[model samples]
Target: MMLAFILLPLGRMFGQQSPAMLATVAAMPDVQGAITLSLEVAMASAVIAAVFGTPLAYLLARSQFRGRALIEAIVDLPLAVPHTVAGIALLFVFGRNGPIGKIAGQLGISFWGTALGILVGMLFVSIPYMVNSAREGFASVDLRLEKAARTLGASPAQVFWQISLPLALRGILSGVVLTYARAIAEFGAVIVLAYYPETAPVKIYELFLSGGLQQSSAAAVLLLSVTLTTFIFFRYLAYGRAARKGRNQ
Candidate 1:
C-alpha cells in the first residue's frame, strides 16, 4: 500500500511532463533566476542556521535547566504555526514599521522584499529541523568518552571540539542538508515576506495561478527533480562513505 501510494504519484509526475516543455521552462529567464536565487538564499540560510543554531543545540543537549523543555518547545514553535501566519508574524516583527525593523531601518538594514527578508522567513520555519537534528547528534555522543578525555587533563572545550563534535558530525550534516532543503522548499512564508525576489517554489506557484497546471508543470518538475536529487545526494553523503569524509575533514 505504501509503495503503491508513493510510487503512483511519483511515476505520474515523471511521466506527465514532456522533455520539450521542461526544456522550455528551464530556458525561461525568470525560471533560471528563481532557481538561482532559491539556491543562493537557501545556502545562506543553512550557514546562518549552523552558526546560530549550533550553540543552542549544544546547550539543549548538554544542559538540564528548569525551563529546558520550554526552550525546546519554543524552538519547535514554527513547525506548529501555519506558514502564512508565520509570514504575517514575521511582517509584524520585521516590517519597516515594526520595532525590530524600525531599529534596523535606522541602521540601514532592511528586511523588506530583500534577501534578508527571505532568509528570515526561511529561518523561522526551518531552524527547528537543524536544531533538533544537531541536538540529537550531540546527545548521541557517549558522555563517558567526554569524561575520559576530561580525566586525561583535557578541558571541556577541547573535549567538545575533538571528541563530541567529531562523533556527532553525521547528525549535524544531516541537519544542514535538511535545513537547506527546507529553506529551498519554503513558499508561503517567503511569498508574504519576499515576493519581489521570487524563489523557484514561488515562481512555480505564480505560474500555476497565472497560467495553469500545464504551464506550471515544467518548472514544477525541474524543481522537484533538483530538490529530490539534492536530498538523495545529501542523504548518501550523510549515511554512507560520505559520512566518513566529514569526520576525516
Candidate 2:
C-alpha cells in the first residue's frame, strides 16, 4: 500500500499527459538516438561485465586461496562508493593524462564524450551484479559433478564448459538482466564521463534544466515505459524458461 501511494501519483501523472506533449516526445529524432545510445551502452556493459566478472566469480566460488575475501571486497567496492566518486576515479585512471588514456589515445579510442566512456562507467557500477549472481550460481552446483567429469577424461576447461556452465547459466542470465537494468538507469557516472552522447537519463536531466518538469516528465515517462516493458518481458521469459525446464525434467 505504501509503495502504491508513492508510485500511483507518478503513474497518474504520466497517464494524464496531454496527447500533444506525448506526440512531441514520440516524434523527436534525438529520442531515437537517446534510446539507441542507452541500449548500446547497457548491452555493451552487460557483455563486458559477464566476460570479466565470470572468471572472478568462478574463482570466488572455487578458490580457498588467501586474500580471496579481499578480492571479493574489491569487487564489491563500487557499491560502497558514490557514483560521482566512482566517476572521478575512473576519469583519473582513464582520462587523457592517465596511463590507460594514453594507451587508448594511441589506438584512437577516446573515452571522454564517447560511447566507450559510457560503457566503462556502466561496467564499473553494474559488474557486481553479474559477479555476485554468477558466484552464487557456481556455488550452488555440486563439486562432485565437476570431479566426475574430470574423472571421465574431461579437461578442466571441458569440465567447466560442459558441467559448470550449463548448470550455472540461469544465474548468469539473471545477472545479465540485472546488470542491463542497472546500466540503463545509470545517471551520475555517465553524465560526468560522457554527457555529449546523451543517454535517456541524461536527456531527461537536460530537458528538466532547459525546459521544465513537463518536458522532462514526458521523456521520463517514455523511459519508464520502455524500461518497465523490457523488465516485465524478461521476467516472464525467465519464468517460462524455468517452467519449461521443470516440465522437461
Candidate 3:
C-alpha cells in the first residue's frame, strides 16, 4: 500500500524526466533562483526554530506548570491547521494593516510580498516539528544525570550546556532536519504571503499553471533530487553521531 501510494508516484515522476530535460530545467535562471531562495529561507527558518524553540522544548520536558498541556497543544497546533488557513491567520498579524506589520512598516520592514513573509509562513507551519522533536529529545535524557551534576556543584547553566544539551543533541538535530524539510516544501502559505521571490515549490506550481505538466515536472524532479539528497546527508550525520555515542558509552 505504501509503495503504491508513495513510491509508485515518485518513481513515475522521476521516470518521466530525462537527464537532458532535468539539466535544461536546472540551467534556467528562474529555477536556480527559486531553488536557492527555498534553501536559504528554509535554513533560516530551521535556525530560528532551534534558537527559540529549544528553550521552550526544554521547559516542556523538565517542568510542570499551569497550562503546560495547553502550551504543548498550542505548539502542535500548526500541524493540525491547514496551510492556507494558517496563511490567512498569519495575515491578521503580519499583513500591511495588521499591528506587527504596521509597526514593521514604520521601521521600513514589510512582510507582504517579500522573503520575510515567506519565512514567516514557513516558520508558522514547520516549528511544531522542531519543538516536538526537541521536546522528545530533552525528555529522553535521564533526570538522574542532571541531579548528579547538580550534586557535584554544577550550576544549572553548566548542567544544561554540558549534560542536557549534549544528551538532547540527536533529537534537536532531527528536529532541525524535519523543520527544514517541512519549510522547504511549504507551498500554500508561502504562495499566499509572498509570490514574487518564488521558492521552488511556488515556482513549480507556477510552471504547472503556466506551461503545463512537462515544464513543471522537470522542476519538481529537480527539487525532489535536491531535497532527497539533503535529507539523506543529514540523516546519515545524525545516525553516525548516534552510533559513535553508543560505542563510547
The Cα local distance difference test for each model comes to 0.90, 0.87, 0.94
TM-scores of all candidate predictions against the true structure: 0.94, 0.93, 0.97
Stretches of candidate 1 exceeding 4 Å from the true structure: 242-249
lDDT per residue, candidate 1, 29-63, as tens digits? 99989888888889889889988998899999999
Enumerate residue pairs that collide in model 2: none
TM-score of model 1 (CA atoms):
0.94
For residue 48, model 1's alpha carbon misses the true position, in angstroms, by: 1.0
N/CA/C clash count, model 2? 0
Best by lDDT: 3
Clashes of each: 0, 0, 0
Error of model 1, residue 249, in angstroms: 15
CA error at residue 90 for candidate 2, angstroms = 0.9
lDDT of 3: 0.94
The TM-score-based order of candidates, best leading, equals 3, 1, 2
Error of 2 at 115 (Å): 0.6
